[model samples]
Target: MTMNKIYSWQHKLWNKLTHHADSGANALLLKGRAGIGKLDFARHFAKFRLCETPSSTSEACGTCLSCGWFEKGGHPDFYHVSPETSANFSGEAAVAVDRDESAGRIKSKKKTSQQISIVQIRALSDFVYMTGHQRGRRIILICPAEAMNAAAANALLKKLEEPPAHVLFILVAHRPQQLPATIRSRCQLINMPMPDVVQATRWLKQQGVNEPEACLAAASFAPLLALTFNDQRYAAQHDAFIEQISASRKINPIELAEKMQQSDLPIVVSWMQKWCYDLLCFCLTGKVRYHLSRMTTIRVLASSIENKALAAFLRTLLVSQQLARHPLNPRLFLEEIFIKYATLLDSNGVKRSS
Candidate 1:
């Protein structure tokens, strides 16, 4: 609940939610794009519902015992379930923040796993049947609900099938399609509101972000993502990647792949996918969605790569993204993709000087 500050655009939804503070809905699923504040809204709503001395509008008073415990990250009646890799989880497994030196000490001991394991779901079953320490509503918040694997989702489904009195389940899903149909059907769905371009821009400026428009485009209009987009190093690396890939005739596939070996594979692949998407878009209609700032370069590159070859490379990128999550040799993986990309423009293996 500590990081549940709502954005300006969510005012309407917030007002609507206040009306249903005491509703009998056992489960509420908030689904939307990543960085649109669905999880934060859930946390805020949960805190408001559990406050012993809530205001007339049902907002947390912040001075009550419940508010204090929740802020300190030890509210007995409150439970947060997410992927092990998610930093929102509490206790020794909490994700470390860079602001504190000691935070890394514990986090370095173990790499956080990505899936919300079946063990976590099973544990929730026991907690659901148990009494709330404060005789209040027990709130269980599952963030990025799609992180649950088949076994974990099945275990969670059992709890949803048998509702416990005085208990509430709040599931926040960024990609609801990834969730099982049965699990999604059991919850009352709330689609998180998407901010208009003007509102998102204003919010980004308020967060002190430079080049707000460009950042928003990069994040696909996710305002929260635009706010946190301050990685200068990654921007430089991406620019270099674009340059290399655009001038495929002169670039050395092996050398470029080796340079990117130490970089984040998933992000690199994501950027490549976006780049390909823009190329395809340009090939079809001379329009670019993601790399607006590089329109001229994209236009030039789009004309060079075969439309059919570009389509096939997009599929390769999708496969690479899935494989990037698992253990694999970075150099070899990157090399293979780069080699395949090189073949698209130069099947003769001829290296032209820039």
Candidate 2:
């Protein structure tokens, strides 16, 4: 359940967390931008806490009962929560009613549109307060913890303030700032940054990604996005997005956003991130080797911008990405970005025919 290959820094942190030598925080909050091996790290931590014979100097033995259940993903004492709006699945997963000693598993591909509800939090609280099912402590992992609605947050806050003994909570979040102040104050924050391209490249290759460079090009070193980028399901759609941006060069920003909403937004944002990274790489390296998803497009893109301009474009891309998440109209957000990108390229004396 741990990263098959752990990096040096990750290994150091893993050691402290496992051995509890870094003992200031009972609850560890692993927060980071998307795709920095946080999930993998969390998995490793959970496995160690649930280890039947947690040793001082070695990783968990796969032969143990707890490790076996972890591999099977059937351990009742371990709980992992994720966002209700998770793209990996169609619905939300959470604890069962009353958090009573009930056995519920993380359900992906669920179509229900429920957020982490108050009931789920109550169940979690009760479960943590109850006795452990095994010899060690019970572990609760609430990921993308910001996705919890108001009621759920309140319920969770109470538990965080007075968590039961031998119950460990690991909260994973892409944006910790979005969490309640109480929640943030109650736990220890661990920053997980995005991996460098070299680290990313190595990890991708280890994942058996044949075209790891291409995946990197397509995802801007966001490992989970790169993982999803291995296929071409959204390739055509990205092309369509480029076409939309190209055609919106002179259009009003708001109008442009509406027109740009015809394609899948998440995938487009991912590409935009990759392109920004590629433009930066090109500006520095004078070569574009990693952006294989649209190497030709990036090559053309690189020739048109200086490093400053590329940085600005990346900023706009970040704006677009954040705006894509707000309750704002998606179309307007998309159009604004497309227009801005087109304007940037055009001002740089590079024009793509609409």
Highest TM-score against the true fold, candidate: 1
lDDT of 2 by residue, 90-137 (tens): 012332211100111112122443356676677675567667778647
Pairs of residues at least 3 apart in sequence or in different chains that clash in candidate 1: none
Candidate 2, number of clashes? 6
Off by over 4 Å in 2: 1-9, 21-24, 85-119, 193-195, 234-236, 246-267, 273-320, 326-354
The numbered model that scores best in lDDT is 1
Which ten-residue region of model 1 has the weakest summed lDDT?
98-107
For residues 23-82, could you state the per-residue lDDT of candidate 1 as single tens digits?
Answer: 678999998876676766777787788888888865789989988887777788888886
Compared with the true structure, model 2 gives a TM-score of 0.69
Error of 2 at 253 (Å): 8.1
